[model samples]
Target chain A: MSTPTETDAFEVDDSSIERMRFYGRLFLGACIVATLVGIVALIALVFDVVVEAWGWLTWEFLTHPPSYLAEHYDPSNYGDLPTGPGGIYPAIVGSIYLIAMTAVFTLVLGVGAAIYLEEYARDTKLTSFIEANIANLAGVPSIVYGLLGLALFVRAMGAGSSLLAGALTLTLLILPIVIVQTQEALRAVPDSMRQASYGTGATKWQTIRNVVLPEAIPGIMTGIILSLSRAIGETAPIIMVGAATSMFAPPNLTDPTGSFAAMPMQIFEWAKAPEDDFQHIAAAGIIVLLTVLLLMNAVAIYIRNKYDR
Target chain B: MTANGPQTVTTSESDGATSDDAMTDDAPLGSPRVDDAVIESRDLDVYYGDDQALHGINMDIPERKVTALIGPSGCGKSTFLRSINRMNDLIDIARVEGDLYFHGKNVYDEDVDPVALRRKIGMVFQKPNPFPKSIFDNVAYGLRVQGKDDGDVEEKVRTALERAALLDEVEDQLDSSGLDLSGGQQQRLCIARAIAPDPEVILMDEPASALDPVATSKIEDLVEELAEEYTVVIVTHNMQQAARISDKTAVFLTGGHLVEFDDTNKIFENPESDRVEDYITGKFG
Candidate 1:
């Protein structure tokens, strides 16, 4: 009923301080050790990749196309391939086409699904069922997606060995990731932002388009970048959809069936060959792939930092 | 703390039976009720799922006046305030019962478009949430989205910023990102963005609760000034703030019931209910 007197206020406690210090040391030491291990592993991985691939990189190597039968460098001795260095010209083009188409399709379907789930879907049995399936799909192996692409696009749809099949499969592979990231981005926007828009008499869609999406742009971009990088590095699914090893040129969208090889499948094929020359060539291809991946990842990091405020 | 619930204690002393007797005696020459109040509610109730959050409530919010809604946490003061603008419709499980009128038109009417309604009534949130854009862009967002290109958007942005009392601090840095400002400046920037649409009313939910004393006072002063041009409704937990800045105050209690509504002076000095008296007197919330 009464305030504490001076005598009561002066009572001190010392026993708990030592225990708190002990816990603090334990937690801090664990964090420091974990961070150090992660840094060391990343550095070692980069060193290994650079050392193995350094010899395969050269101006001619990047600009030239692959030759058959491990013969002499003379063009007259080989199967008269395209003018460029066994340059991954076709693979590079295919990768870009594959990634762009995948991104567009995924963005529409993934973001749409996220908005529907977040704004309209109540926590009903149907919504819960869909959510559980999405989380599980994110965990499904990339190779499985490749097989699905092979069956659905290559066989049933009869779009075998084409960029279209590759893109459609990649879209399926990344759809769950895009949806999850978009949902997280949408959720991070403060409820107050939505309230402010609604208070202004903004309609649900208007509020989302005007206020909610603007605030969520940085997050959405981050998700897009991450998903795109993943799509670029993917090799199994494209091979499943039949990216061939011998295609010397890029294919148009409407052209019928044709085998198209990507950088990863080429690298994998060359790496497994018996000849040392092919091994070095595959290592160079790996180097180029790594460079593209690095650039894409850097872009992702830049976007996240640019709008992180 | 005082053993009596704060609202009950405050209201008991402020109005109690004496003021009611006094009010009843004035029935023959009763106070004139303004028919054109900006927001009118009758038997308004709100529920979150099966839980009833707000009980029946009736009140008329006069136009161009600073009306303050005060209550303890979870008392549904914000809920009632949000209902005026139909902001509760955004919440998935939130359901409202009863009629809410804005300019004599029921906002819940099937024909009413909430988006159009929102364009006419802007809002500032408790914490400053400026779009991650330049100061000019943040201010021009509302107008630009509404297809308003009446002239130079820059000039209009400047006017809105000036009205929010933020221009002097930010005019030189219109291109700078809104996040670069200090907390108070950012809050004002949000206010500028809210007013850019020339909204008829502005709803502010605890706009000053997150600021320091100086920033809080600045916001209070801004609210007083804004009342001259727009119907300003603010919800605050700070009783002193309500007493200081608002012309009218509505006191709310537990479970979202409005206990009393009157002139600020009357609510603080002579409230009509024991619950309101207890609340303002620093007893239990």
Candidate 2:
């Protein structure tokens, strides 16, 4: 009524609009920088490792063992034949052995505990306390597991610094992960499904075995794959439990119980050496480790995509 | 909607005539009990925690008969149906009192197992909940849980699907996921799953409520056919559906009290209780 003025119709403030744009740009810019940092770091690591190990990624380097004599060592020399110094055959075999043992032991212990906790154990004060303690154990340092393995399995248990000791330590280290993952998998199954099974005259154990486990298998497998990848890359525990890098070749399926050298321990030993050749071999070892981890993660991703729906 | 006195019908005890033949053509099939009774519940009461859902309810459910329970929202018709199979025991807070007899056996006995009870008495829910498996596997689930692994599972699954009136549509897509089916098809698949184990009694809690008119008619026909073998008890909100399908009708009021139960036609045209009459007439629910 005072006066139909144009400024009265337009009360928008330009400064506030500019402030909003400023925050939006700040957020977007921060995200872009963080993403670039991750990509650049990954590319740099890949380039450095690939360049260093280019000289050592030959068939000879893969098929022979580390030589004891310097005259015949020939670290950089690939002789006439396809064979050469320092084949990772022992380390590969040993890593597989360690991983298998870790898987079996961890699955048995972890899934068993999970089943008891989720399906059977009463959710009382004691059970809650135990659950909290297990979650806390997951955050404990990996090196602390190594020290524990040395104290318990090696000295007290008289297992020595053998593959068994290393396997046991790695198993304990990943047991918490498996337990947590298994619980999550079990929990993901709908309560109605369980009721349906029970309503069909199936007993409690029968319901868990037939219905619940089948539904949770994919999730459990994904957890197992991820855990195995971490266990394969674990060095501190194995080193603490005395996995020697000097071992030529340790064991196979037929002799699965025998002691062996693992890839991480071998890489650690080679990386500590001052020679440039040893560094190249260490880089190659790292590449192999990365390959295994990549394969495991790929399998996990494939399984998760296939069945998590 | 004032309360009217009970209209006492002076029909003879021997008069077994149904009030309307249009809806009562599909009579259930079971061993003809010279004394016609399948389930007998006496002074039944259902409680959830401290709250009582159903008061004392006494009724005789005839074998191989379609008995429809109708009520307004929050009525205890579903609760009454669940009590027959002891399905209420599944709820942690639920408590049941008095006696429910199935084939003359006390379902609430100390030694009685709810799982065993449910095996004889299967149930279908309002919403379709087919397992996230192939159509064949979904039907075979009930049998599989019973350890029927003779490889004749396929034949039984087909038979059940056929009985549920879904075989013609899904026969070609046996391997397809059950969830891929339309809502009505999925509901029929659930019905097939329920009947696959050859349960003696099938309890449907608003089985057709989620379906459209066409799908509802299909289910109604399917239920009629199923009555030839399995004793059927259906809970529905649609009074017309109850009149169209059920031989016997039970009307429950607020607080889970059974107000009237009689022939479906009688309950609709000339209900014994004023409350039931008012409910059916749309004066009150």
lDDT (Cα, tens digit) per residue for candidate 2, span A106-192: 889999998898878866889889888888888888999999999999899987777778889999998888888998999988876
Relative to the true structure, how large is the alpha-carbon lDDT of every model?
0.77, 0.80
Question: What lDDT score is found at residue B56 in candidate 1?
Answer: 57
Off by over 4 Å in 2: A1-22, A67-75, A80-84, A122-126, A252-257, B1-35, B149-152, B253-259, B270-285
Q: Compute the TM-score of each model's chain A versus the native chain A and list the values.
A: 0.84, 0.89
Runs of candidate 1 with Cα error greater than 4 angstroms are A1-56, A73-87, A253-257, B1-36
RMSD of 2: 6.9
Clashing pairs in 2: A64-A87, B28-B64
A1-309 per-residue lDDT for model 1 (tens digits): 157677767444545777899999999999999999999998887677677656556665555556544433233333554443455556666677778778888888989999999877888999989988998999999999999999999999998878778888999998998888898999988886666556545557867998778777778878887888888888788777878875667656466356566778777777787876675566667778878888888887898888776
Candidate 2 has a DockQ of 0.34
